[model samples]
Target: MREFKTENIEVAYADNTIIKNLSIKIPIGKITTIIGPNGCGKSTLLKAIGRIMKTKNGAIYLDGKNIYELSSKDFARQLAILPQSPIAPEGLTARELVSYGRYAHQKGFGKPSEKDKEIVKWALEVTNLSELSEISVDNMSGGQRQRVWIAMALAQQTDMILLDEPTTYLDVAYQLEVLELLENLNKEHGCTIVMVLHDINMASRYADYLIALKNGNIVGTGTPKEVITKEMLREVYHIEADIMIEERTKKPTCISYRLNNRKIAVEAGIKKGIKVVG
Candidate 1:
């Protein structure tokens, strides 16, 4: 297992800084979900950690060495990132897309070796896409397409996988299917999984650890039982939420929530230069 951590990092887009002085240590071999309201810099943090974007300051370390010091192929061999809504080339079959993951392991000309082919086949089997390997990605359902993308990542044979909102547009059933597959990946193969999720209940149900962010800062980080709370919802989302512990999985669940009018009114009043007494 490898260690991944960021040290006091800052990320910016031109003049606007999105994340400031952030530090995080991703627990190895676990499913970690980053949650917060929109525009909290969750995706920005993921991009930096995945090396898809650069940080303006500080260092990201992989197993004690700075990530910038590693070559692209070397880095890709260790971790794979599946961006949200990845688009495949038209007419590309599931197997064809998965074959691309062998790029880093290949030498010049990047021909698929027998070992690469075998690994790709195994990835398809594990993802339950072996039969659909010949189907064009564009012709598949949303869940199938997502699995194809995941199979591509799996073919990389990385110890860690980073995903951004893997269930964004899927229907509820497909959402559960994807999350269950990820759970199996963690439990069976021991892959470290990190992703950003919009649904608090889904995140709570699937995640072994949760990192909650608000306005570019980490507001809470812990297990679901510790992080998913009424106070956390109030602080991070400005909502009053009812929390419960699921009996089957023993995970925290957010059953109901509504906007906190008093908090909203106070902030609005303060912004308008009114003396508000609570």
Candidate 2:
């Protein structure tokens, strides 16, 4: 497993900063979820951590060494990233696509070794895609194709894995299946898993730690039981909600009950018993 530390990191595009002096430590061997509203720099921060974005300032350290100093191949060996909305080449079979993950581990003019094949096989099995290994990627459903992409990342066998919105475009059942697979990876192989999640309930249920962001800054960081309070929800998301504890899992579940502006104005009018034409 690997520990990542971002210090005073900043990213900008065309004079508009997307991330500003943000810093956070991704815990090793645990699931860390980054959650925020749309355009809140969640995806930008994930890209910065994976060295996919050009940052204007600050540094990111992986396993106590500067990530920018490593060669591309060496960095790929240590880290693997699955970005949001990845494109796949047409007509590639599931097995063929997963085999590409061994590129970083092979020598000049070398084919996939026994160990590489084993890793790829295990990844396909874990993702429940072993039955479709020979099927073309273009012929699969969206959820099935997503699992294949995740299997490719797992085949890389890196110490750290960064996934941006991994559950996007998936049905409710498939979403839970993917998250369960990730949880199993962390628990069994002790890999560091950092992902950007849109569903707050899933983030709280699956992650060991949570990081809430707003306007490129961190608003809260802690375990779900500690960080997902009513006050933090109101401040970070601008919503009034109640926190409920699940009896089986004992995790905090948020239930938002705030009225919209129009509803609030209507309530006020009713309180005064005034009826007027619009």
Candidate 3:
């Protein structure tokens, strides 16, 4: 298993810093998720590790070698990133976009060789986009467009995939399907997956390892059983919640939660003679 590790990386937007001196390990071949409130540096940190954003300080290492030392193409071969908003140019077919994933493997003036065509075909089929391969991106729905982008990422055939809010457009069914696909990739191919998720319950449900961030600092990091708790939720999100262990999935599910009206809730709980975290 290839270890993807980050060490004290700092990222900024001009003079304002978004990701502080943060360091975390993305366990090889496991689904590691970064979860945090809005504007809490989740996306920024993902971009830095993907090399989509420059780190103001520190470095990211893959298998003990600094990622910055590798060539652009070399890095692309091992890691692929699917950003939240990927631009699809006008007149670009779904097939054309997925084929772009092969750019790193191409030598000079890539004209789509037999191997490239096969890889593209596999990517489309895996994403269930074979029927839509020739369709214009403009003609597809938001969910279909998102799947097209994911298909392009899959075509890269990397061991690690970094995604930022990958389930933005999908309904409940598609959302579950996409998450299942990620799990299958990890189980079948030993692919290390890292993503940023806003949904606390979804993060807890799908993530094998969870990294919780609050205001550019790590609130906690552990398995869902250890990380998802009433106190952690209260501390991270300032909410009162009832945590329950699901009998079927054995996942911790937060049922009822209310935002930071801590004193009132605490007082009410005390008056009712019940335990509650303020």
lDDT of 2: 0.87
**What's the residue-level lDDT of 15 in candidate 2?**
96
Which structure among the candidates has the greatest TM-score?
1
lDDT of 1 by residue, 1-278 (tens): 47999999999999899999999999999999999999999999999999998999999999998999999999999999999899999999999999999998999896799999999999999999999999999999999999998889999999999999999999999999899999999999999999999999999999999999988999999999989999999888889998888999999888889999887777778889986686
- Candidate 3 TM-score to native: 0.90
Error of 3 at 266 (Å): 14
Clashing pairs for model 1 are: none
Q: lDDT winner between 1 and 2, please give it.
A: 1
TM-score of each: 0.97, 0.90, 0.90
Error of 3 at 70 (Å): 1.1
What C-alpha lDDT values do all the predictions have?
A: 0.94, 0.87, 0.87
The top-ranked prediction according to lDDT is: 1
Candidate 3 per-residue C-alpha lDDT over 12-104 given as tens digits, one digit per residue, 9 for 90 to 100: 999999888888888887999998878888998899999989999988999888888999999998999999867799999999999999999
- In candidate 3, the residue pairs with backbone N, CA or C atoms under 3 Å apart (3 or more residues apart, or in different chains) clash, namely none
Task: Provide the RMSD of all predictions against the true structure, rounded to 1 decimal.
Answer: 1.2, 5.6, 5.1
Candidate 1 off by > 4 Å? 268-275
Q: Which residue runs does candidate 3 get wrong by more than 4 Å?
A: 262-278
- For each of the candidates, give the backbone clash count: 0, 0, 0
From the highest TM-score down, the ranking of the candidates is 1, 2, 3
